[model samples]
Target: MSAKPFSQGVKSPIVHTPSSSSTTGPEQDERSTPTADLKSAHRKVDRRLVLWYSFVYLIMRIHVSNISNTAIINLEEGDGIKAQLGGLTSQQWAWVLSIFYYPYMLLEPFATLALKRFTPRLWMARIMVTWGIVSMCQGATVNYAGIMACRFFLGAAEAGFYPGVLYHFSFWFPTQRLSFRIVDPETAAFLSGPEREAIIADLPSRAPSMDSKTFDLDQIKAMFRNPTFVPFLVIWITHGIGGFGITFVLPTVIYELGISDTAISQLMTMPAYAAVFLILLTLGYFTHTKRLSPWVAGIGLEVAQIIFYILLITVDNATAKYIFVVIATAATQSFFPIIWPERIRATSGTTSAGLAIGITNGVTQLMGIVGPQVYQPKFGPSYRVSYSTSVGLLTATVATIGLTWLLVRRQDKRTEAAAIVESEGVGLPGEKDRTKQQGC
Candidate 1:
């Protein structure tokens, strides 16, 4: 019992203990590592790419939004380009504006399919350059038909770009990280070999097969059955109609608000546009952090818009009317980002997601056709008809959102119930012999 202790040259069978640095094996190390570390490793490359894309996006926004500004300047200044096209009636101008949507809506789905078959970098470059040329041609057009033709071609060129980018994001990000709104090249790169195989192994059996290259018609049809899809479609359409109507008539409205100077009228509209930009960014952040339903946001914003539109139509005070106009414009523009990610998140497979986005965006853009018609010059100054129409549309949007939220909640409960039954090794209510039902 009083024998030599273990450390006293007893040479106890050498027990090996792992050092702190070498404790984790490769797989464990990968699993335990922080996602932020991986993102930071690729931050340099991501930053450069983001900067480039941001510049491109900025240019695209300018090209699209400048049409409203250009139309107003031409109508009011009656000089140079204005004199050439100013004689055109408001109805004719509406036609010009509406024509842009025809090709855009019809071809967007096809464009998204093409993106799947090609590299996004190449496809996006082609789209941007072609649209740029077409935008310049629009400025040079001398008459109604000329501008209309340019707009049509421009729409054709830019048809799927926004939705295509969204689809591209789906390929590069996981569901949980999608709300981060930043590019994650690490995910893209890791999803290539063994890591990808490991991930795909865990996905549901219904997940898209990796070998399938072509789009599936059945999958596209199934998207229509998804509860999230129709609501998003309706919300976007109503929002687009109301938003575009406000945008096109904003300058005229400002002028009629007793701002006599043409430059002053144009300048006054800037604050509203600026407010829209800020509101979108702020709402995006808020919704992401709170895990808020897009429908809730949509309903809230649409209600606000309805209020603003009513005031715009009923209020007589110039300043009060202008305030309402700005608030309405901002509310209208803020709903898209909230709803877009929600709709796309509900879609599963890559091809299905692309088609869903393309179809949703293409159809919703039909608002372009209706938007100009709503803001006719005959209703100008007061534009009572226009504001009334907007209120109606916003009300419809709120109803659609309410329905969507209900469906989503119901779906969540179903999912949770299914998971509970599975975990408990229980058969469905009618089924007996849970052990026998295991395979099924």
Candidate 2:
């Protein structure tokens, strides 16, 4: 929210925001943040929140991606889930998988707004726990209606987690390091007194909307006008539908490949995820150390997906098929994370950041709604049809990334020009006009 460009984060100031109810809070004065003592702050964030949130998000992902794996949990013995649930038809099975996104898409935005009402740690833990319970209920379900109900509730429970984390990050770190922090005076019970002060001291360098209201229609409305909004939405649409489609059916695809009995089919699915994790780790490093823009990161990853999806569609060899699956999953999941950093960079304040991210995430949830149907049983053996769809979507995602980058770059230049005008406008009108003339 500062005039200083923070899309890269390397030279960005260390700004913090506090809760509205907190006695100690962010400074409201604008000045260059002292970069000297920020080491402790960065270390603290990494130690306390980074690894912890990683684990938390990992659990959420495993749960989200588990349905496809769960479908084959007790397979080969005729005791699979579809068999338990009244021998669900292909359409019925698709609906059961798709139902999870209905509430997830609808409630995600409002659920993100509730972070201020319930506080981050409390609200997020509730979501994590509730989804776990809902998932547990799925294991106990004995009928089609019961499974459908559980899936729907599961979607409702997980609705806010992603966007809420994005909102939380806006308060603590700039775009890149934001993958790893959270704090406020009211909630800095984990920090020493000085450490707490360091994060919450009142300075204009403080984040712009630390004390913003729980809901702001204006901010929500502004999101539509943000240069990056529609582009972000389009990328999410492709990632969610295509990326999720691949992930949701991967286990079944492996199974259909004659990977043999028992759990080998399920176990083999693990490698693709491992590859995804490694790709994400590497991408984070590039974003952090190299100051890589999300557009560059996203485009590179989407291109990888497009390439692999093409290979997957055209290739016929069994071993190569498995290899391409891993590549496709890794490309898509890694690319999916780039949107968040770009989303945060595009929006200025907490409200805009939260709502915009929520909206984008909501659109991505369309993946869960529409993804499973892409891999219906009719297209089994070698689901080239689905692979073609992914290739097409990934191609679209690449174009959207370029469009978003161009738009965001244009906005950035405009902002920089205005910031220059304001900074030089400090003197006589003639001098200001001369500065503007020079800029022009």
Could you estimate the TM-score for every candidate? 0.80, 0.85
lDDT by residue (1-440, candidate 2, tens digit) is: 11111111111212222111111122221212433334465566556655666677777878877778877768777888889888888889889889999999999878876765677667777898898888898888899999999999999998888777666655555543443232443245655666545654422222424465656666566666655677778878987787768787778888887755548888888888788668776666666554565567777888888888788778888889888888878777666565565455556555665666677778888898888899887788888898888788878877877887776666545444444555566444464332222110
Query: Which ranges in model 1 have alpha carbons more than 4 Å from their true place?
Result: 1-34, 41-50, 74-77, 80-82, 174-212, 415-440
**Clash pairs, model 1 backbone:** none
lDDT for 312 (candidate 1): 85
Off by over 4 Å in 2: 1-36, 179-182, 185-187, 192-208, 426-440
State the C-alpha lDDT per candidate. Answer: 0.61, 0.65
The clash count of every prediction, one per candidate, is: 0, 8
The CA lDDT at 373 in model 2 is: 92
> What TM-score does prediction 1 earn?
0.80
User: What does candidate 1's lDDT look like per residue over 1-440, in tens digits?
Assistant: 10000000000000111111111222223433435434553243234344455566677767776766665664445562435775777788778778888999999877875665655656777898999899888767787778889989999999887766665544433322233342223234523444444433322322223244547665666666666677768877877897657776577677777745566777888787688678766665565454554466667888888998998888988889988988888787666755665565455454566677678779877778888789866688888899999888878878887776676555434444454576588769743332111110
